[model samples]
Target: MNSSDSLKLVVKQQNLEDISHYIYAIVYPIVFLLGIVGNLLSSLLFSVTKLNRTSCGVYFLLLAVFDTIALIGGLHHCLNIGYRVAIPNATYCRARVFLVYVSMDMTSWMIVAISVDRYLKVKYPITARIYATQKLAMIVSSIIMIIFIVKNVHLATVFIGDFSSNAADNCDANPLYPKYVAFFHNVWPWIDLTTYALFPFLIVTICNAFIIHDQYKRRVKLRKRNLDRSLITLLLVSSISLILCNLPITILAGVYTHISTSTNTND
Candidate 1:
């Protein structure tokens, strides 16, 4: 080959290598491991430990289940990409998309439910007793699941296909159907962030703030500093974890959207 021909071949080879590395080395394994480990630990801890059978434990358990499902859906996509699987046909694509969104929706709402439960328990103990029973928590979780399923089932009807005939292996929805892409990548992330990250953060912060304030007042009135410290520590840890897990996901979703849109525009 001539020099110019060799240079063109080199560029094409590098591009192919970049795509391969992204699918196999970066995206797939990170998402798979994190999802499995995080959700499994949450599930096992809640299932085996008697201490995890509280009203809050019910919420955590449900959250763990949804997280696992979401992670599975995510991992499936990652694996398909890494392996250059054809993804069979549109039926699998639709089902995978539906599962991904539904599980995500359920996870967000479960976090919301947990936040509300915590708020009630801290702010109105009597009301919390009536409203936040384990049975009640289960019922609420069931309703959330139903709502998410009904709302996102439309995804199962949307078909994806490989547009690149040159790469018989690549699989994705046709960009001609921009609506699905818009909904999946753009609209849904905002909704998820709002419900999962922003609202939950606010609820947890307010609830914990009040709890700490009340504890401080009680400690001052009763002169019991030692007793208050332990309670404060527990509440702080819970609040911090909730915030930490949620904030990155929300921020990353936005960043991902921006990057996706920019790339699409360039294309």
Candidate 2:
């Protein structure tokens, strides 16, 4: 394209991104409110429901708790990135990013734990009894949370709020590693995309597939009746949702890696 055309293209792209940012600002606040309220109600319901007294219910309840935290982080992200509401507070900037990632990581891993617990319970009913207890679910969720918090602790230091700088007023983590910032931005997101998103997606899919197959066998080969298809359906739906929700961010990470780092002009 010619220079004029190129300039128009860049401006158009920027306009679209701005439009998307504004849209996100509007939508995410609603998302944040609904998420908090819905998760709270669900958490209470799970805690009271007799079905949640089981190992599976415990996992679901913990997932709800993690999701609630993530939703709070989501509000921070929407306000800060979309509207610059939290950009002035350095502590909030740092803490919000850390909490966002850590909570999201735990959320994904908890689903993994849930899927595995269900798979084992169906695959090895007797052996799974001791392994898939509420206590075990709690321990696993806690460990996963701890591991992610430790892994992402560097976020707090990296994300600084320095209004003195001429960089945009948005809450972006400055490039601490100046020369390597582009490379870092390009690669680090993928590491998260892999460990937190892709890995959990693959694990959940495999576990749920096995669970479904086992359920089918029990129904067809063994002449079993009264199968609880609801649980299986829930697992399938969750697996699909994880992939669908995360794939876009993972793709955007790559897109940002390419565009933001090409000239070291953005973060």
Best by TM-score: 2
TM-score of every model? Answer: 0.67, 0.81
* Model 1 Cα lDDT, one tens digit per residue, 1-267: 899999998777556545744865477688778878988998899878973656778888878888888778766434543443434456666677678777776776676677677767877889888777777877888887887788766667643543343212233445667777666566766766776677766776777778787767767889876556777787777678877877776775455333333323333
Residue range 1-267, candidate 2, lDDT tens digits: 899999998887677566646755898888788888888987988898785767888878888898998887666446544654435566766777688778788888888887888788889999898777777777877788788988888768753433332333333446665644553455678788997889999999999888877787778776776567797778779899999987776676455433322212333
| CA RMSD of all predictions | 6.4, 4.1
Q: Over 4 Å off in model 1, which ranges?
A: 1-38, 48-53, 80-88, 159-186, 224-244, 247-267
Q: How many backbone clashes does candidate 2 have?
A: 0
